[model samples]
Target: MTRFIEIRNGRVVTPSCVIEDGRVVIAGERIVRIDRAAPPSTRSETVVDADGRVVMPGLVDLHGDDIEEQFAPRSGAETDPTTALATADRMNVLHGVTTKFHALAFEESPEDGRNLENAARLARAVDRGAGALGDNRVHARCELADASADAVAALIEEVDVDLVSVMHHAPGGGQYDAESFERHYVEDRNWPAEAARSAAEERSGMDDASQGQRIDRIGELARRVGVPLASHDDKGRDDVETMAAHGAAISEYPLTLDAARRAKALGLATVMGAPNLVRGGSLWDNLSARKAIEAGVLDALCSDYHPASLLAAPFVDTGESLSTRVNRVTRNPADIAGLPDRGRIEVGARADLVIVDPSPTPTVERAFVAGSEVIRASAGSGAAPELPARSRTR
Candidate 1:
């Protein structure tokens, strides 16, 4: 935290607007100065020429499925925690994500490589690996179907987290109807058609009262831990209201416009996956993120499962100002996460920023976290890959 860095000749995205060809000065970990005119070259500061790049606040991603994927790049294959974090941290910094919340889903989906033990290991890795290139925090995504309230609390005591979310991933429940739920198991998870169908039918008959009790207990635990609580894949206004009554401060991925509107009405921050905006719509066809943005119901965008999408969303021409879109990934999410010091290009804010090359598809040219240059793109080191172009992205 004892460094000084200077970046000049950049299109700096400020809180309210873009400052064309501006300069930002960082001292230690906070932004010290910002101006349109160039400051004279100095000896104490390491100066970087932006070369007409876009300079903006580093992203504050609330959810991404990266750590698990990094820890197990291949199915049935695993790596050590340190190696996994090193890879995830590198990928995050290269994509302009300075503060990333590893969404650790506590489910028994072994086919997709998630279990209670695996979640704990990943949480411990992030907990132990402090001072990574970018900030890493845990988001405990507890599936009420598989985890008891006591088990969820026990895991929270084992390792601290940045936020918590509760959900039920069953047919006729969160994120799915009977057909889509069964289809997801069959198509995505490779479950047998009959088994998936049978599972869906079984889930539909579960006791709602029992599920509500689990939600209350988890909500209490989140309140005790003093982190933001979120409800995931909400499908209706009633779902939004029910979660909000339990102190849920954020609503992640509301499946309908009515649900999003209700979340916003209930003063819950509404988050949608960035990939939905990038790929034109939701992959599962719940609610269109672009539609949410246009309806002015969405509060922020999460990476969901794609870190690249967060970097790409702010510049995707959503008919909003660049500042507005940038804040959706930066300021809004940071605010929701109770991080007031980062996610803005303002004096006295943490100097977490990224400089991007946006012409041929956005690429992180340089990234700074808390006044430290964690990543700087160079030809000698090989160019970072461009944003992926595919139909089924994320």
Candidate 2:
């Protein structure tokens, strides 16, 4: 039973060049051909006319935490993990994110239910929903101060974890500047200023030796599982050096240009938040992702907490070529994650594609994963489709 899909009459974007009026042929789960010639099509072969739109690689988001919003939309309300993850899959596919690493924090944020136990529950749910619309993977964000290294190791063994990142959110340094930490605690979390300060102080005062041991343990687990490891919120060259020493292959949202450059020099792929580029700067007043891009330190862009930003961030030109910008969300992250089968439109690659209408407003017209049409835009629906809206590509 051979399945065939032909995407014709589109500007097919590839790693090196964009082919105009090209056709891509998908056989089963892999792209079998790409050419200007119109290949003979059987009646059983499905055909998609791109209508002169941009057909590019589906985005690969290496780090994103938007699933937190799905499970706990409000302070006291919580949805079932299965329901929440199913909802997330639809949203991710609509935004052209064919592959997503759901960043789950293993910390004690009990008020928001983003604790270690909840993370494990969500990971198991993701494993259960493995046959969903998009490629869903778990990215464990281990808080160094949490002292849950052994628990995280066990959880990785129990679940299908794809990535791990070591994070330290002590108040005075890294991503959490003093002002930002205070605002987060007082304004966002609605905590008393004194309580916030005390918590920050407590986190900062954790035994350094214990924190180092925890990081080492998780790093070892990542190696054992053969998953990529990352460092989050690196503050400076020293921080980058330490993480690199612990076998961190990626640097997730380094707080400063110096840190990003240092990580790149040390052979770590640097990931920055797409929201920072879309919003023009960091919400927490950290180093700007756009600036990092201009400085040539930014390697890849992740949705972070907003899935929409992944598709929209590439449209923001920061002096990089169009292919390079698109690669930040596609090929680069895929390569970092060690997924060699996807992230490009080439012969023998996975048929993970995104069709975008880049005029008026950039919109995802349709998406396909593994040669199967997963999402499609409705006629006359010029605006981006909301999660509730449904359309079948076939």
Query: Model 2: which residue pairs collide?
Result: none
Please count the clashing residue pairs in each candidate, in the order shown: 0, 0
After superposition, candidate 2 runs with Cα above 4 Å error:
37-40, 192-195, 381-394
lDDT (C-alpha, whole model) for all candidates: 0.84, 0.84
| lDDT comparing candidate 1 with the true structure | 0.84
Quick one: how many clashes does candidate 2 have?
0
1-394: candidate 2 lDDT, tens digit per residue:
9888888999888888788998888998899989873755773378999989889999999988888889988877889998888889888888899888999888876655767888888888777674467888888888887855766777876778899999887776577867788788778766668867877887888776876777789899899889998998899999899889889999998988899999999999999999999889998778899989889888899999999989998788788777888888999999999998899988999999989987766778888888888888864857555333322211
Enumerate residue pairs that collide in model 1.
none
lDDT of 1 by residue, 232-311 (tens): 99999999999998899999999999999999998999999999999999898789999998899999999998899999
